[model samples]
Target: MPVPRPFPPRPFHGWRVVQAAFVLAIFAWGIGFYGVGLYIQTLSASRAWPVAWLSAAVTFHFLVSAGLVALLPDWHRRFGIAAVTRAGALASALGLLGWGWAPHPWLLAPAAALTGVGWALCSGAAINAMLMPWFDRRRPAALAMAYNGASIGGIAMTPFWAWLIAGWGFGAATAVVAALLLAVVWPLAGLVLGRSPAEFGQHADGEAAARPPPAVAPAAARDRAALLRDARFIGLSAAFAIGLFAQMGLVTHLVSLLAPVLGVQGAGFAVSLVTVFALLGRTVTGWLLPQGEKRRLAAAATFVTQVAGSLALLLGGDQAWLLLLGCALFGIGVGNLLSLPPLIVQAEFPPAEVGRVVALMQAINQALYALAPLGFGLMRDVGSTAAAIGLALALQVLAGILVLRRPAP
Candidate 1:
């Protein structure tokens, strides 16, 4: 009796759901998001299409996804997450094929639209919705863990796509990757996403029994319409949108900016380093995030770090070590920007309204980020690299200010 040891607790099924969401994010971000630049380059080279025309298609792809993502909550409510996810996989597969097969410039419109539809259903909002039913208290950590897949997707897929295109040509590469996406995501959607916490005789966070949902303040909004009008909602959405606008613009131009200083191979490595730092940053923030107002402050601080990084890059100029340092600083905030918004929504809104709020926020961010590349590129063309970086840095500063302006009770 004196030497007795306690039994180990069983693994929580919610963690398994996290794992599934993680895998889903990998493909969603890989093919739909990170692969866009490669698509532009390949289509440009092989089809002899104008880069400007292809870039517009890329912009349209993001805009379409933005519109569709706003409706994601409603779609999931009506059709169910698993079914919607399966449809997304199918759409994504077809879209990838369409990218390679489209013979005319105008054809890219339908191809971009198809990929946009797929991306809307498979990306951030979808991942958040997938995990919402399973974890309440642990939501931050779960999302942080799952969102890392996006970074992993970028790190793994960019080079992989380039290699595939190099070896097999665009058509064969697209077919193979599309096939792999369908094979993995279709079964995954059915297997893991089909079940809920209740199905496994569990409550959120794998609790022993049911507990009351988190308390909402008397002034808290209850429905999507009310949430849309809420000051907090507006503030949160604006801050994230502005921050992401900067992040997306900077990232889209980062390789080109660094190439002048670090050379081609070094520039590519820097971008990969940014993804690595993003993974590390998001993981740390998610695990250590405090509740309530402090969370907003933490989010604001991330923007501040990015601002400093941008400034460093601008001032660092042709100095490789200083430029690399700036990249590290900027990279630290990249994943946090994506992961923190949902956490903010969770903290400010009631459990019932979380899905819609998150969806709307993501929609807003995407709409702005859709324009980021063009906006930044224009700045570079009209002025200089410093001007583009300056524009991003200014927006990030504004984002930090906006986020800290929590609505008064």
Candidate 2:
């Protein structure tokens, strides 16, 4: 007699979590992060606000969000992911509405602060916490798929917002986007994200029923304190801080940089192109590169491309082809920059400590990168656009060097 065919593999809940995280990331990054530059341009044109002043609002948003991200580990433990995310969704809606209706520049500050809080709850840190419990062997792939939502967000929203503001006015356009956020994100949080695998009697990666859950050492206060002083953590923080500072500054000014040459719509498309290549970069790294040193080296290389991209834009002048080429090279590294940090922490640190370490690093990175737009904007106001961009490029080069240096033993 022929043997019975082997049973099909059971479905993994981790993949489900990844799907939920993907959707959440789309809204979080699309509206919360990537959309800010669009807002800055619209508000500046319509209200005649100074670019530096409007950019400061974006900086404030990041500062508040960074502070909240630093507290996420404790918040996740106390409130659960579902509650935190749901609350974030509500806050984001309100923040968007407030931003749309704000009558003066000062009013934008509180609105941005609210958005910051919502972003801290719903973005990368939230994705990490949700997926960590349900993945191990497949974590990198899961993260890559989930985080690609961020690039997709940039692809979808940049042009849409530009068109929306052009047609419907900024206030109405902002209101519509806010409604979309609530409708899309709230239900997903309730359905797929609240509970961990253990809560439902499942193992990570859907391993055999007989397999025991991995034991994670609880992170002690002293351990966290020690991490603060650790050379590796310090190195990672410095590299990413400088890297993101440059990246954010360039991206925030990208539309303004390209608009004179490409017009508003063309500039939006250029931003989308950057995200498209970013998606490809993250996908290739996740699929082909093994975790650890190879991944770290790949990340370092991406920053080098970012430096090259910056130089191209600066030198390309008003040539559309050259500017687009520069964006393509820069985009190749964007997603990897966002996705690699948590992966590196997960690979190097203890499982229990991963959350805290990631939180701390994110907090520090956000705090530094928050200054990018404001600094770049001020430079643009006082110096030439080329001077502003040149400064950003120099920072990217510094970051590349810092990241390439091997950590101390």
| Cα-based TM-score, every candidate | 0.95, 0.90
Checking candidate 1 for backbone clashes, the offending pairs are: none
List model 2 lDDT by residue over 203-282, tens digit each: 87777773565586455543557888988888877888899998988887898899999998899789878989999988
Off by over 4 Å in 1: 1-10, 213-224
lDDT of 1 by residue, 1-409 (tens): 5988888655678888889899988899998889999999899888899999999999999999999998898899899999999999999899999998887989989999999999999999999999999888888999999999999999998888989999999989999999999898898888898678767778889989888644754445366677678998898899999999999999999999999889999999999989999999999998999987789999999999999899999999789988988899899999999899999888877667788889988988999999999999999999999999999999999999999998863
Worst 10 residues of 2 by lDDT: 216-225
Point out the worst 10-residue segment of candidate 1 by lDDT: 212-221
Please give the distance, in angstroms, between residue 32's alpha carbon in candidate 2 and its true position after superposition: 1.3
Give me the candidate number with maximum TM-score.
1
